[model samples]
Target: MRFFKLFFVLLLYGLSLLVLPPVSSSEVVWSISARVGDNVTLPCEAPGVVDFEDVAVKWTRPDLGPDQFVVFYRDGRPDPDNQHPSYQDRVDLVHSQLMGGDLSVVLKNVTINDSGRFECQLIQKMENQKKWSESKPISTIVLKVSDPDPIEARVGDNVTLPCNTSDVVNFEDPTVKWTRPDLGLGQYIYLYRDGRPDPENQHPSYEDRVDLVHSQLMGGDLSVVLKNVTINDSGTFECHLIQTMMFGKRRKRSRSESELLSTIVLKVSDPGSTGNRTETGDEGGHEDRQRHGLTGSVCVVTVLSVGLFLSKKAKLSKSF
Candidate 1:
């Protein structure tokens, strides 16, 4: 009788082990970069996920404060009560591929203050289990932010506006638009899409004069050069990027995200008048200084872009 009792106890213990198994964990980290006012994707992919209908995903910035929810989703919708006020309308799941194990989130209108470390936690409901068991962290994403400063140039001279993507652009065909707030309605200074310029949609003043400096657009520079710039170019210039790509293999849906890459103020110095000058030199000397200023401005832009790229590359290397 004692042997039978011991056998029964062992059977019960084995059944309990099957019901409540030890949870495994992984310390995976990811680093992501984005510019100010850009819409970026923080990846948090998972594996072995059969269904997301009963899964719960939570994203938080623990460095900011305890229980600081960046975004949360469960029960077939976002949890309206726990999200932080600053990220209320700016955070969301990029696509509905949670079932395929993609819990990535898109952050809109990113600012310099948004840079920080984010944590993603995923919990899945088990069949016939009333209690919840936590899975290891899906990922820890570190957001690095950069700024695109304004530029200055002179009229009748060539100017290159610098703009680069924060992350690698994998879309089939991406479009970049350069617009001036001082222009008329429904018109842009430069419009490049699918590796070609849309001349019909460009402003008359910029036709055949503005072109993308970078021919190869795959994760490279998107800067444009404007020839024979005029005094009218002295205004706020905005660079916007749009791209469309397929999301998941099972879902036959496409997703597009547009990001405002940079906004620069071009201060065009008139050929006749030395604007913002103190009358400290002759006309010839003034022209030489103006040329020097333009060169210096371009150098500054180049340095800034190189610095940003180096920083991003360093962080990405460490993450991988």
Candidate 2:
């Protein structure tokens, strides 16, 4: 009976090893998009992290220059020997979440230079076991950076709306679209393709007012200039691009629709009386005087006071 019991225990242990999976086989990937100056959290966790306080976790950014050590942990504390200087005070781990199989880190004050792929690796140590099993990439986070701030402009003045690409642009078969949500769909402010504006599909209000003033579309400049802007032009403007690429030895053509390169807010303000004050004319002066309640009677009283003082001075000189 003792021999049988020992053999049974060995059999169970052998079966457990066969059923257990490798750490490298399990990995999670997540995509994150954020604007400039934002705080983001990158998650990394595994079911195997339960009850393992001694875990080795390291985050790295291979795309960025020089420094790759984003965060490194060993024996329950962070190691700062090879940490990147740019991420020194900006990166931190959540210990509460880490206890629950989560190795997530919160990055503060994110900048455009921080945009790239981030990899998280973890290894949990068994309590009674001498050997530690390292977990593969628990998470692969891709951070895409963009700037979505509004651009201010004044009415009756020309304004340039900026939108450009970081990659090479093919202008031969390019499609650029500028649309405003307030104007509804299909009523684009400007539509350019094959090197010319598509006036047939353009909105009548922006018929001759919109132009691709960049003059260097092929050089990757997609900025547009609006001439004689109106108050109605104030709204969100989206710039979409679609380009064709030739690939492979056969030179097969492929079309890839680009994401909205940028969405610019056009804030159109009326020139108002403030701007009209610059005109050098009597009408402008008269309007300004009325606005400030500077009546003609106040000016006449000042002139009479000066004349009375002059008459008194002549009488005093004769007496002397």
Candidate 3:
């Protein structure tokens, strides 16, 4: 019995090494980053202790105050009425996945007015207890304003936008998605991941008209091709990407680091629609348009197309 007891104690001690450490009162762990006026997330992805109904969650902007808060969840409830005035409507919990350690905060309409550091704190106590206990970690959240590159395209025409990465070891897996912000959130004109088109997230209007533009991690080209464009297709397009491991990427990537690159403001314009309409009749249209003296600035052949150009996004992200 004595030997068995000793073995059990030793095993218990060893197992403790595998468990997550208890958070300390001095440490703070929550991160947020964003461009001015852009939505940002301050994530406090830390594991939680389950079944503790009396436990509480608190959010405070340390730079703003010692106890000032954007919001807080306590005693299994939220206190929005008592939330900090400035963050009353802007702060939200994406950390409902907190049980898995995801304590993320999503902030919308991010602007210069929303600049600062955020903290996520966990407090707990039994209903019968009068005192509350709290824990924290070492993490800081910061925000920055970003202006992505602009790309334009036209319907029935091909538009190319690149998802360039600065330094990736090897693109063993690559994903390219073209998004039409005009379609609202979570909408896609075309998406390609791992070199395959994802029909699951396809936009009905883009059916059969989208294709991969081109990709070569070595050169940081992840451009997607959109064909048979439409007027409604014009809007902001973001080039999303993720790195894939390749065989010879180490040495090559060591010279370069894996990085996420994006460009926004992809506009799809109506081709020749902006110009004066020539009477339609293949020969008549062509002859009349010319005879009518339609040329130069008047004939823009205007269509939305996005490519590697001196765009504001590149300048903002310092890609170029």
lDDT of 2 at 87: 80
- Between candidates 2 and 3, which one is better according to TM-score? 2
What value does the lDDT take at residue 319 in candidate 1? 100
RMSD of 1: 22.3
Look at candidate 2 and tell me the lDDT of residue 194: 69
lDDT of 3 by residue, 1-320 (tens): 99999999999988886785643544554445565335577766445445446666777776665556777876545678557666765666785535565556777555555666666766678466887765663345665555544566666777665555554434565556666656756767776655677887677888887766554434766667767667776666655554443457464422221222454555777667644344244667678778667654354433222333436567878754
Tens-place lDDT per residue, model 2, 261-297, is: 6678778888775556556576878888896676677
Error of 2 at 72 (Å): 23
Predicted candidate 1 versus true structure: per-residue lDDT over 115-230, tens digit per residue: 99888888777677664456667699889988645567777899988777766775457778899877888889887776788786688888888888877664667789989989
Cα TM-score of candidate 2: 0.44
lDDT of 2: 0.78
Off by over 4 Å in 1: 1-70, 73-148, 246-257, 274-320
lDDT of 1: 0.78
How would you order the candidates by TM-score, starting with the best?
A: 1, 2, 3
Name the weakest run of 10 consecutive residues (lDDT summed) in model 3: 252-261
Taking all chains together, each candidate's TM-score versus the true structure is 0.45, 0.44, 0.37
